[model samples]
Target: MPTFPAQPSPANKSIALCVLFPVFFLAILVSHFTLLRLPYFWDEGGYYVPAALDFFRTGTLIPQSTVTNAHPPLPTIVMAGWWKIFGFHILATRVLVCLFAAAALLAVFRLTRTLLGEKAAWVATLLTAIYPVWFAQSTLAHADIFAAAFTLWAIALYLEPSEDRPQLKVAALFSLAALSKETAIVTPLALAIYELSLALRASRNRAVPKIPATKHLKSFAALSAPVLPLLTWYGYHRFKTGFIFGNPEFLRYNATANLSAYRIFLCLYHRIVHLTLHMNMFVAVACAIAAILMPAIAPRARLSHPVVTAISVILAANLLEFSILGGALLTRYLLPMYPLVILICVAIWQSHMARLQWFWLAGLTAVAFLAGIWINPPYAFAPEDNLTYRDMIVVHQQAIDFLQAHYPEATVLTAWPAAAEISRPDLGYTTHPYKFVAIENFSLIQIQRAASDPSGYDTALLFATKWAPPQNALSLSRHNSANDAKYFDFHLDLLPNEAAAILHGEVVWKTSRGGEWAAILHFPRIVDARLNPPR
Candidate 1:
């Protein structure tokens, strides 16, 4: 592997960055297109969809009020603007996300160099360029890409010298960051701690006079600039949901869905142990550990290193206690923090930037990139553990297209999870535009009971991994109608090696004597093809 130059030279820095920037962008572009556009990630459907709702109806950039994706105003705000250009194509959404990813990369580059020397910055940027978890998300329509940028930018500013106007910029960017996502709310708190540390350091400077009481009060107040927007969000959420944060629905859902404490600790330990086994990734993880340990190992000199300071701040901001932070440990979830992680690696290496040391660091980064591709980090959920990106998107698309071609005018129903996979036409759910009903309404026992009942509808389509017919559904006219119930199944392979067992054919059930369910299951449905995609 090629090595970072032994001595940090400004010219070398420029050349290295010049060579790196294009490579990074190309990786991003290729991943974005090659992933078959990965059509609207699940989170995109749930959160970002509503952000575009206002613009879809009013044709305005500032979308009308919505309940979902309510935390971040900027991404929704940007999405609203793009909705006009593409008029609602999923491609357009991907384009916006790609653009944001590029911009986020630039931010990483800038902050990387600012903290680490130029060589370390290049190493960090290069590693970030190829991190699969981050790469996967950079291609989607989720707001996290932009949210990560805003959050990182806020952290960057706070870490810069106080007199450089970074404090004020930190305040502004921190607000923008917080407004981007609930995860980003950590930005301001992180900034406040770092700024407080800076203030304390300044106060103890012998040459600098003690901060006067009034000045100290004023300084503290200035640090609070980011609080306004956050407080506004809080007040609005309080009035709307009777909660301080936005969208009480998510909390309720998470409370029921997410794993509890004992499980949480187990998951954390599992991930830590899981990552530890991967040689290449473990190297990067080791760097992260060293970066954390450095400040304590040699506090005086470590504090002097701007790069060390930057990495420390990022780690503190991101590595929340296991009790509070919960997620599937997606690389993108930590992507906003990868640049810092990379810098930490560089910081550990830079303190010993011999020619051989540079070579070793470069080799390890390359190993990480290779492992990233080899393991195929599970950024997006996979139905089968080993399912590839092409399998997930391309094969899934075919199943949808097949459905549309075969049942042009029929309502299609899927099991709980599979239902999400095919809720719309653009996503390739095909068939005619039929009303979407949640499969969660039925339990296993109920499904079997419904399966036994013959006096229902004539034919119903089932789409899912596990096929269980719902007994008493709104779409069923009568609970036990002695009607024909034909179970047709579609066997599809998203990839040659991996096949999706789809249960979307037809079901025969009954609705009560007279209701909406009677018409729903009985009617044939297909996409209008006239309604534009979600704007």
Candidate 2:
């Protein structure tokens, strides 16, 4: 086995592993179990859970009739099968996803142990398990944790010294990563670069005879051959749908080759700024400086370091992919790099900062973990921040209760999130649930259809949440104004002004909870007032 910079005593290593696993597991469990019942917020209710239900009904890989080719079908299908077996309950699905989370924690521990040392492995695993984003994402039914787990395991196996059929195992693991998420195709690319870098270092050291650059290129290409299955999947989609991935609308709105360079810079800037601001600002800034200065301060140790090289490649590939392809730039888009970010911090600490009291390192990790709680919890710190699971749960539950009590049979005008919640029979609303129309990018026309305004549906519910013009139009709305196009992917163009115009009527019921606002507007009253204006 190859030795790393830090090798703890065998007894110490065993003690660390024994202590780390249970503590990390308990942290994840305690942190996530409470949030499990927080209704399918964000993409869970909006797309994934519904797609899983659709898969259950249709028995096909393409779960949604909308067939968002934006992603491969693996996550949705897996969730669907789990839902079928376990029954479609929020806690059950969340627990299933948590199993993936546990796998990720194990992968992180093993990878760090193999490359760094047992002590570093404990630090990395604890950092990963406690890190707010990874913890929160693990609880949610998303493909990201699954992809990250598979990719981490794949890289771990790829770095391992030769065992029987190691290459084959690595190849299969990479394939699994791709199956979990399309962007995971970058895993093998990063690994290929890592391999080539090692070969180059070996040749320079006279460990092997100098080889032609073309030979190295060919070898890298061969290592990347496992990505062919991913290519074939995209090919099948193209052949069937005439669109390359699935969601042409998403591609149209988010991608542009002509402006890829510009988009790349902007996206990277956005991500970096958000990371620094929301994800433990001080620690984030410190980590960035450490990663930058590590090479200059310790060139020899930094340059040829296998783990650092692999992490750098993976991070670079992820950034380049999003920059070039340019779609709805979200924090989640950078999730594959989350583990890398934690690992980079661990590497820096292991290299030069270990002399500091051990509690200092643990203190910083604790700060990052706490920062995530505020980020993930609704109205925990930011009152108007709707970028949380709790916001949806609190607001949607109020609206659902109001509608059930008064307008039991009324058609509810809802966006995807609320629509998905109301449509479900198991939510304890009523035996016969209310009807709803699930619209995204809300508009007056959509509201009209959802309410069945002209027909006999007398009451309409406009379950409004964080809808306002961008506070930072210069940054967020640079591409388009709120009146023209959505500034962010989650925020609709239904600005306060637009919503007021549509929702002008006698308010039957209203509730404001967890930084989200909900209201039920009387359609008849609004119509009568419009027709018979009082003298």
Candidate 3:
């Protein structure tokens, strides 16, 4: 009996909505900063921040010694510039990243408002603000959030009524999306599909003739024009490394090494299952299923409604790209997709749930809000089921503290992540107190050689984070004979270096956080034996 207007509200209400939306976001940010004091998260300290520092040091756009151009360089380049301007302390870096997150939140609200009505827009924005993955990543310098920011705003621009130079503006935004992360190449495809769908629907209404195929082709070409910069970067990369995306070693080690088809379905299933189970009281899917049957239940509110159709197409396209092509199903990769889901769910809520007298919507929405508090990186002491952001940051910081206190002047052999963090100048840790030997992979031979060199380290500190496996697991194998396999059997989530360190070196002290451990290891005898193997 009531119709929701799609056009702008009264001028006074419009002004009020704009003011309240930003105030809400500011409050969320202030609350988050007061609650959590996250260090440079796992990837930020280890990979992203280090890479950005290297670029600044070398004055190059590309990260120095980049392997897989797994991500496009723009995010790192931009972050490096930010670090240069603001200085690279953890709080500063995190605050800078939060700015992008803020922008993304605004874009989500604006887009949802355009497609759905005001009530749905507010619901969608609130959901995005509280969504665990998006919220957690907002504080760190990971590129996923940055990429999502670009993609969300680009879609918002693309959805606006066509205007003079609209093609140029949208294409530029899409180009930024791709540059932020290569996976955002899905944007053009989603846009083209939405445009085609609109044309087809118009034709069915007999409002206009079906658009010519050539016109579609021309539009697509214009949409694709901004990709030339991406192509040029690939050209440069190929020239430098003899590979388009990265060097052969990078592909062998990073790209193809851990990739598995099984992870694809696992990724899709986990997000759906986890988010629904945690946030929706398992009602999201049931509601979604019911929406699919809406035509049978209510003739007027088809699931094929245009807003639903457009957002659904984009969400589906993005999921397909990640499942088929993503190297790994990192939670970060799924962050951009969740906001779209929120939009669709809200659309369903508006069109059918209210009219059907479905009380489940109210219950599920309350569950989502309550679920927000529980939505954080697992605790440092949480079980091995998942490694939260806290787990990662605490583990690394503990390792760095142990090294600095115990072997202040010793040469340390560590995986790149620990090495990068300890070496970081912004953390206010003295990098000079310990000489660091950064190694990508662990090896007895390399350690021995480094220790034996006249100018090399006399005492070697072996530091392992959760990501690196020991190059020499021979020690773990030897101990396994004594029924110690359980000690070395790292769960699917952790690396194997801790067991190897225990077997080869005398553990002066051991420390652990979450499922990961780092120990101060002294391996004099093992180094000597390896330097002069049995004849």
Candidate 4:
């Protein structure tokens, strides 16, 4: 074993940071190719890749996706720049997401070290590095990784020693985070509220002592600083897209479907705590218990040093995420929180280097790794994640080449969401030709829009769903009985969508691989809504 320096002086912190950061990042960069070579999952193909292509070709900041509303444009728009250099390689595009994810990991490691101690920090970092959700999401072109990294940076900057420049940096990071995803806008405000709480606590202890007026003023400014960016972007998006949010799809999701306030809130919170507990109920429980014990640990750990301050800022961010976004429902959402928690854990280990404490640290790290953080959950999810990653770019690549050569610049309408958005949301919806209410879901509006509006464009090709498999078992809803299940459960047992039924038209393309070991199907139906799917 090559022994290394345990604790470098504050001056040498920069060198240590420089050395470890790249090593951790490269581990992911190398691991990405080794692990998998499936095509871009679903949304990466649908929303992200297309938006990147649009942004790259059009050079537009607003990367307008065909899906048009569920999320913000920053992730896709930024991906355009990467596509410029990487030249449409999924591996190369993933590297950008991976870099952001690496940044998030480094942030988590530093956060843990600051709050807890070196040992605990390492434990937390190791856990974070291997967490399946974190590992998976980092390798995909999703906004969460960027949001997470910037979120951590914002928390770090906010928690810095009461300095003006640091406050400004915090503001900038928060702004960038918000840009990455609309949900992140709530983070900074949550952070501000927490700092206010700290200020009040300190004030209570000192009636006669002069208040840290400068810090409060700075906090207010930091809190207010984001208004400019929000307003500017709001105006820009509104003017560009004829809507304030700039995406009609989000509006539809919000007004028509999507989780209600109570549901969203409950789901988000349950998601976070559950994931934490699932990773290790004890670690989650331990963190909660340790928080109550912080007053005692702070005095012993010299943690009142900058480490504690950083933890405070991150705690503020965590609260903001929980309160505003409802919770870090997913690990990617808590990427910033991971660092803060790690720092706190590290600080805790440093406070008392007892046998039990080290054992606890080991236990937590072991559990987190077992939970599969190293693979990253949010990105690299299995079949569930498949829809997000299955961009069908490989399929599309051939299609694109064929179309460009034969029917140059024609618009293509694909049946599988992967062909269009490469995301599953399309398939999730049932078109009006058949309504299987018992199925997971179907967006009537999305069906009408996609199916009805093909006449306006000269689309050359349609990449239809070649195969369908049960992603999960479906239980009948209250509104549905056995008969209702037939439509969605299988093509052979479909029901009427008004007068229409499943496979309700001429079967144009059907093959059994010429008496070999395969099956193929191509069927189209014209719906009552005038939404025709070609055979």
* lDDT tens per residue, model 4, 1-535: 0011123234424436667778877988776664334456545655667666777888775665454543556787778778777776656676787778778777766655544445555667776665555656767766777888888767645544333446777788888887787667766776566556656655666564334544655675686576567668778777777777645656643443333465455444444554444334346447545644644443344355434553455455554344334211334555455545545555555555554765566566667555543222321122222222233334444444444454443333344442342222222221112211121112233334444444433332233222222224332232322322232222211111311222222222222211111111122334467767899
Relative to the true structure, how large is the alpha-carbon lDDT of every model?
0.50, 0.61, 0.58, 0.50
TM-score top scorer: 2
At residue 33, give the lDDT of candidate 4.
64
- Candidate 2 per-residue lDDT, tens place, 1-535, comes to 1112333334544644455556655667776667777666656665666677777778756544444655776787788788788887878887877777777787778767765567677777776666656656777777777787788777766655332226666777788778778888876876677667756655576444444444444546655876887888788777766778667666766664325455467666656654444445347447646645643433212213545666677777787676556455555656657666766666566565433533376567667676665543311122222235465567667777777777787876566556656776544334466776455635656654544544545555555543433344324333443322332344443543355466554667767543356666555543444576689
Give the per-residue lDDT digits (tens) of candidate 1, residues 1-535: 0011223334534644456556656666775575534555455654565456565667543324434423646676778777766777766777677767776776677666655556566666667766555666676666678888777766555554333344567667767876676666664665455556656666676785444333433434455666788678767656655656434555544333345655455445534433342224567766546545543432211224544554565555555532245434333445576666665566666654454755586677677665655354322222221123334444445555554555554444434333444554444334345444444323343344434542332223332331112333332223222211211111121211111112222333322211112111233335367876797
The digit string of per-residue lDDT tens for model 3 on 1-535 reads 0011233343312634467546755755695674245656556665677677778678765566433454578877888788789876666677677777877887888777766546666667877776655666777687777888878887776555332226666677778878777778786766676565544554466554445444444456656665776787788777765678676655654445434665456445544544454334345556666765654334322223444555666777766665555443355676667777776666666666554344356446646655644442321112111224455566566666777777666776666556656666444344554567764444444454444543443344343323322334222223322221122122222223543443355556656553355555655543434565589
Candidate 3 vs. true structure, TM-score: 0.73
TM per candidate: 0.69, 0.78, 0.73, 0.65
Best by lDDT: 2
Query: What residue runs in model 2 are displaced by over 4 Å at the alpha carbon?
Result: 1-27, 64-66, 161-165, 193-223, 235-243, 254-260, 274-277, 281-284, 287-304, 354-358, 375-387, 424-433, 437-460, 463-502, 525-535
- Comparison by TM-score, 3 against 4, better one: 3
